[model samples]
Target: MARLFTGVVIYSFFVFLIMTPLKAKPSDKSKTKQNKYGIALIIGNKNYKDGVPPVDYAHNDAAAFKRYVIDILKFRERNIIYLRDATKANLDSALGTHNNVEGEVQSFVREGKSDVIIYYSGHGVPGVKSKRGLLLPTDATSNNAELVGYPIDQLYKNLSKIGAKSVTVFLEACFSGGSEGGMLIKNASPVFTRIEAPKSNLGITILSATSKAQLASWDNNAKHGMFTNYLLQGLYGAADQGEEGNKDGKVSLLEIKEWLNEEMTYNVKRQHKRRQIATVIGEENLILASVSPGRQFKPIQAFEKKKTVARAQRGAYQTPTISPSARASLNIHESYKSYGILPIKLKGKRCVPCENILIASLEGLPDAKILRGANARKADVVVSSFLSRLNVTQEANDAYASAKVMSGMFGAVLGKNIVDHIDRSTPPSFNIFDVELMLTAKDKNLGVSETARGIYFDRKDARQPKQSNTVKGINSVFRQAAERLAVRLMGGTPPPIKSAAQIRKQWEDKDQNAQNGNWSEDNND
Candidate 1:
C-alpha cells in the first residue's frame, strides 16, 4: 500500500511539471521597448527614363534616412518599407489595399496605436487640371504626369483612412524644379502653385523642401538633398531648443520647423545664391522622436576648439604692433576697446529695417563694449554701416532682356518649338544686395572696413513686399556678418567657415568609411 501511494505521488508531480509553462528570457531585440508603435515608408525615385533630370543622390539620401530612423529613432526595421527608384506600379501596389502598406498599417493600428511616416525624395510636378500636387515616379514623365504621377492628396487621404495616431509626410521634391543653383526643367513657365494639404481630421503634418515656385536644392558636397540633410540634423538633436535645466530627450515639431527655416534659408542663400524657405504645416508640439542616449548633441569640435582658443588668446590682452607709418595715419597707440554704434546708413530706398537690424546685431556682441548715446570722442572706435537695396546687376539685366526679345521674336517668326529652346539657353537675371561696415578711430583718421554681399536669383514670378519673416531673415544675415567683423576687430581669429560642399564631402566620406568598418558608429550615434 505504501509503494503504490509513492508511485501515485511521483506520477502526479511529473504531470504537474509537464503542464506548467516557464517564462522566457528577453533577448537584446526584445529589450528595446518601443514607446510608440511607428511605421515608415521611404521612397527615393532617382532614375527617370523621360526628359526629367534624375536626382543624383536620391537613393543615397533614402538609405541614410532609413539608417537614421532605425538606429537613432529606435524604429523596428521590419516596420519600415524602403523603395529606391520605385516605379508607378510599385508605388500603386505598395500603397493600395491588396495586402499592401495600407492594409499592413491598418492592421498594425488596429492591434495597437501607431504613427505613420511617409517620406519621398524625387521629382514633383504641378497638376494641370485640379492643381493637385503630384509626386513623379521613375516611370513618370512631364507629359504623362496626370497618369503616372502619384497624387499627394490621394496619398494623404489613404494614410488618413488607416486610423493611425498621426501621419507625417516629408516631400523633398520641388514642383517648379527650379533650384537656387539653376533651373531643372527647361522652358517651363515659372508659375508658382502652392501645395495645399488635404482636409483630414487625423493629425497630419507635411514638411516640404521649398515653397510652390522654388526648386528643391541638391548639395553635391553632402551627397544628399539640402533639405534632407538639415532634416537629418534636426532628427539627430540639432533641433533641441529646450533649456538646459529642463532638457527633455525629445525633439518637438516646432523646434524642427524653426531649425529648418533658419538653417535651410541660410544654407541656400550662402551656397546656392538663392532663397529657399521650408514649409511646415502641423501641430507645433508634436514630439517626433526621443533623442537616443548615444546620439546626444555635441558641439562641432573644430568650431568649438577654435572659438575657445581665440577667446583665451584675446583674454591675454596682447597688443598688435603697428608700423610707424600706419600709426602716424591712425593716431592710435593702443587697440580700441570701447566702441560706439552709430545708426546704420541706408543707401537704398527699402533698407530702413536693415539699419535697425545692424545696430541690434552690433550691440549683441560679447567682447565689445557698446557705448549707447555717448559722444564719439568718449569711445575708442565708431562703427558705421551702409545697407543697399537688392538690385539686378547690369550684365544680368542685359542678358535677360536680350533673351526675352529673341525668344519672343523667334516664337512669332519661326515656331513655338524654337522659342522654348532659345528661352532655356538664356540664364535668368541675378539679384544682389550689398552691405558694408566701416570701423573708424574716434579721430576719424584711421579706419578698417568689412563687407557682406549676397547675390540671389529670384525665382518668384513677382516680388512680394518684405514680410516679418523676410525681415527676420535679413536681420540674421546682418547679425552673422556683424559678429564676424567684431571678432576680427578684437584681435581674435573668427572661426573658419566651411563651405557646404566641403562639409558634405566630409560627412559622406565618414559615413562611407563607417559602413566598411573603418570607423565606429559611436562618433555620430
Candidate 2:
C-alpha cells in the first residue's frame, strides 16, 4: 500500500505541472479590467508662413490622424483630442482645460483613473535651442514659432502631474530624435523620464518618425506618414505576427517595433519610395496581449514539425542528379548550406490598395500637398519601385482597371482608412531572398534587406546607387536571382508589362490617397 501511494503521488505531481500551464497562473491574468482605457492625442499641422516650408502636405494629416485614432484605431472618441488646424486658440483649447487637447486629457485620466496615453502623427521643426524639437501649430509664427509649437517635454510634465502610469508617443515628422532615449530637463538638469513612470511609477514609450538628422515624409498617400500608419497596423495585429506567447491578446512595446519595422515598411514601400524609421524608447508592462495563444501556438512546431516535411520536399527538387562530373564541378548551395529562399505569397490586396487609392485622393484637395524636399526621394523611389514588382499582368488590365474604377467611385464617400481588412497572409509568391538580391542590383534599389526589415532599402541609400552596395549580403543565390529579375524588369522584356510606367504611377497615386483618407470602402453600394 505504501509503494502504491508513492507512485500515485508522483503521477499527480506531473498532472499538476501540466495543468498549471493550461490554467491561468497568477501572472497570466490582467490586474484590472475596469481600469483599462487609452488616451490618444493626434496632431497634424500643415499651415505655415515663410520660406519653403517642407510641410505643405501635413495640413490634413492631423485631421486624418484624428479619425485614425478615434474611428479606425478604435480609441474612445471622447478620450481622444485631435487637432488639424493648430491655431493658437485651437492649440490652447486642445491642450487646455474645457477643451479637447491637454485639458480633456487631464479630465480623462482623472475620471477613469486609467493610465496609457498615446500621442502620434505630427511635424517637428528646428527650434531655437539648436537641437530643440518643436511640434508645429496652425497659427505658428516663424519669429516666436517655437512658442506655438507643442513641446514634448511639456507633455511629459503634464502627464506626470496627472498621475498616469505609462505614455507611448508616436510622432511622424522630421526631427523626432529629441523625444526619446534622452535626458528630460527638469527646470534645467537632465534626467531620465521614461525609465520611471512619472506618477505612481508609470512607464512611458516614445516612437519617433525618424532620427534627428533625418526627415519624415508626408502626403496624400494612404500610407499616411510612414511611421504612424505602420504603428497603427502594429497595434491591430502585426506585432502579434508569429507571436506565440500573447497572454492577454496584447503585444509588448518591443514586439511592436520588431514587427512594425518589417511589416509596415513593406506595406509603405508598396506605395512610397521612402522608408521611415520608428525609434522606440522606455518600457511598459502591457502593450499588446494575445487573444488566442493555444490556437496560434507554433513556436517549436514551426521548426521541428516543418523541417522534416521541408527536407522531404527538397529531395524532389534536388538538382536532377546531375552527371557525376557536374556534381563534382561546382555548386553554390553546398557553400551556403544555411542560405535558401524564403518562399512567400504576398497576399491581402483586395482592400489594401483600395484604401491606399482613396487616401492619395485627399491630396487633390486644395489643402493637401506632399512634403517638399523633406525625404521625398525615399517615398518616391522605393515605393514606386516595389509597385513595379506586382504581377498584375497586362491580361489583368481589366481587373486592375475595374479595381481602380471601384476605388474612385467609393472613395468619393468613405475616404481612406486603416480598418481591419483581411487576415494577414504570406508575402508574394516570389522568394524574398531572391528579391533582395535583385533590389541590390538596381542602382536605385533600397538596399539589401537586413532581416527583411525596412522599406526594401535603407533610407539613406534610396535613389542613390552607392548606397545599394551597402546592403548586407546574406543569401547569395537568391540575391543573384533577384538581380537577374531586376535586370529583366528594367530591360522591359518581361511579361505583365502592360506599361510598367503606369504601374509605378498607380502606386505613387495610391499612396497619396491612403494618407489623405480617400481610399474606397464600398463598390457602388
Candidate 3:
C-alpha cells in the first residue's frame, strides 16, 4: 500500500481521504452557507525560461492546495482560479485588466463580499531597486524585476481593491534564495527585506514561508515544500485546538500558526541544521476552515503503524514497573553507580543562566552521585541536556512596552483607553524554551537509554516593574525543570507538562499586569 502511493500520488490520496464525506451523516452545510462565496487563486510556477532555476514541486503543491480548499473548506470549484507554470502575460491576463478573468473575480467578490485566498509557489526575488519583494512568473527575469516581477505590494493592493470581506495570502517562495534543496538562484544576497502589507479594513492576513533572509526548504520525502505540507495538515484538521473546549472541527488562523511554528522549527533544525522562522501577520482568530465532526487527516499513519509493530517486537526488553523495595533488591542503584553530566548544548541566546541552574540542581540531588572531569567518563552512565529558545526578539519586547505606555496615556486623555483595552485581550510575546535531557550507559553493554522533554515559559519578564531579578526568575524555572527530569530518570512519575494554553495564560496574566502598571516583585518560582 505504501509503495502504491508515493510522492505526488500519496498526497492525492491524502486529499481524497480528507475530502470524502462520511456516509449517513449531514454535511457541514449550515457552516458552509455562511461562507458560500469564498474564492481562491492558486498559482504554481515550475518551468522558468530564464536562467532562474525551476521549483520541483510547485505544480504538485498547487494541485494539492486546490483540492484542499475545494474539498475541505467547501469553496466552490467554479470560483477557484488555478494556474500552472504561469507566464508573465498569463498572470497579467488573470490578475490585471488584460482579460475577463480579473473582471469576473472582482465582480464576484464585490457582489457577494466573498472571502478570498491567494497562494503562490515559485521563485521569489528581492527587488534590487525598489527594495520590495517580487514573485516571479515562469517567463520573468531576475535582473528586470520592475518590468517582469509581480510586486508583493501590488498584489496586496489588487486583492484589497477586490473588496473582499477577508483576504488571506500564502507565499511559498523565499525572497532570499538559500534553500538546502539546491533551488536557489546564483549570487543571491543573504540580506532579507520584509514584504509590507497595506493598512486597510479588508482584514488581510499573510503567511510567508520564511523570513526575508532565510531559505524556504523543500522536503523530498514528502515531495512538497516544507511550509505548504504542514499548512495542508493544519487546514485538514490537525491544528484544531478545540477553541471552545470541544473539537467541533473548527480551525483558526492562530491554531494553524502554532502548529506550523512547532513543526517547522523542529524539522528545519533536524534537516538543515539552520533556522527557518515562518512569519504570520494578521488577525489570529480569523477562521481559515472547518472540518466535519470526527473527520481528521493523518498523513503518516503507515509509518507510525510500522514503528508500533517494531516496538511490540521488543516487548521482552521493555522496562518494568517496580516498587521501591523491588528496585533495591535487584541492585538497580548499583547498576548506575556514577553518572556524568556533559556540558549542555545551547541553541539560542541568553541560555547560559538556565544551563548553570540545571547543572547545580543535578549536583545538589542527594545520592545522585554525579561526577566531573576524567572520573566522569569512566562512570556507569552519562547524561546530556539540550536547551532551545524560540520567538524571543527585541522587537517583540519593544512592541510590548510601547503598547503598554500608549494605552495608559490614551486612557488618561480619552476617559477610556482603547489601546489598553485591546492590549488586555491580545496575546503577549512570551519567550518559549524547549528543554530535553537524555541518559545513556557509558559502556553500551547495559543497553540503557532514558529521555525526558518539556517546554517552559518565561513570563515574569513581562510583568516585572524594574526587571532587576529576571535572571533569578529564569534560574528558578530551570531548577524546577531539572528536578522533574531527575525524577523521571529515577523511574518516578511527575505531573504532566503544561499545555500550550496554560503557558499562554501565564503570559496573558503578566500582560494584564503590565498594561495596568500594577507590577509586583513576586517571582514565578
Judged by TM-score, which candidate is best?
A: 3
lDDT measured at residue 167 in model 2 versus the true structure, 0 to 100: 58
C-alpha lDDT values of all predictions:
0.58, 0.40, 0.59
Ranked by TM-score, the better of candidates 1 and 3 is 3
TM-score of each: 0.48, 0.40, 0.49
lDDT of 1 at 237: 73
Tens-place lDDT digits, model 2, residues 201-243: 4355667766435446543444255565555555545566545
Tens digits of per-residue lDDT, candidate 3, 407-482, equal: 4544464345344444653335433332323332232345455455545444433333423444443444455556
Q: What is the lDDT of residue 170 in candidate 2?
A: 64
How far residue 210's Cα lies from its native spot in candidate 2, in Å, is: 1.8
Model 1 stretches with alpha carbons more than 4 Å out? 1-32, 97-112, 177-188, 241-246, 294-525
**Candidate 1 Cα lDDT to native:** 0.58
For candidate 3, the TM-score is 0.49
Q: What ranges in model 2 sit over 4 Å off?
A: 1-37, 51-74, 96-102, 176-202, 218-223, 242-248, 264-276, 288-525
